[model samples]
Target: MRQEFDEEFEQFVRRWSPALLRVAFLLTSDRGEAEDLLQTALLKTSRHWSRLADRDAAYAYVRRILVTTHTSWRRRRRVHEVLLDQLPEHQAGQPREVEAGRALRALEELPPRMRAVVVLRCYEGLTEAETAEALGCSVGSVKSQASRGLARVRVLLDQSHADTAIPEGAR
Candidate 1:
């Protein structure tokens, strides 16, 4: 029975690795950090494989671990950090890369909880109740977080636009 579960778990990882890794990357922004985060979450989730309610819901289970783990890491991390003018090597020079980078940078400014709410709701296309379940919060909290998170993102994006805009005839 244990060996069968292990084989099933391995198959699950092989099937979902790409999608889960992408979500991890989206959540963390740094590729290396994302990989580490996902690996940790997967390790934690696998320990309770037989106890999971549904084997098909492994991604959701793993995502909850990822979000909570990330939140914990953020709390432990220091506030001070340097900013860079350039994109990470993996993302540079791609189509729409500049705009996407700006948006991601703005997203990073949000508090950890708010960022998770926004990513789960908006990025993952989860509904309010679904997001609430994922975060272990009330549905009302999910709604408010989504609203507040969007407002903050809007402000940040607007500011970035103004900062990068060409003057009247400069274009």
Candidate 2:
């Protein structure tokens, strides 16, 4: 039984790590912090792996740990923040990369909860109910947070677009 659990746990970790890391990165807005968050969550998940009956529920448990952990971290470092402008460009294609990079920058500006809501909904493609479950919040909260987060993102994107627009006089 232990061996079977170990195998399944290993498989689950491999399958979910990338997605988990992406969510953690968005929540923490720092590569090092994201790695730490993932490590801490995985460690917590491993300790409880044997008790998890439905193996599928492991992701939900891990996500709960992530939200709780992030909340605690936020309280500790309440004011320390990094602006997205400081992030270096490492995009692939010149045009698409630039566009996506701007989008990412805009995402980085949202508050942690709002950012998590957006990442789960937009990036992970989770529905409102699923996102609410993952975040341990009401579906209405997910809807509201997503709507507000998206509005902020659109404003930022619009500002960026306006900045790059060629003046009519110049054209």
> Which candidate number has the best TM-score?
1
Model 1 TM-score relative to the real fold: 0.89
- Go through the candidates in order and give the clash count of each: 0, 0
Model 2 TM-score, all chains together: 0.81
Predicted candidate 1 versus true structure: per-residue lDDT over 36-150, tens digit per residue? 9989998998889889879888889998899999999988985736699986676546748888888899888888899999999888899999899999999999999889999
Every model: Cα RMSD to truth: 2.7, 3.2
Candidate 2: list runs displaced more than 4 Å.
Answer: 1-5, 81-93, 166-171
lDDT at position 42, candidate 2: 94
lDDT of 1: 0.88
Candidate 2 lDDT over 1-171, as tens digits, reads 889878988999999998788878877767899999999999999998887888767777787788778878887886875677576857455878678767888987888788889988998788999999888899999999999999999999999889978899999
lDDT, candidate 2, at 86: 72
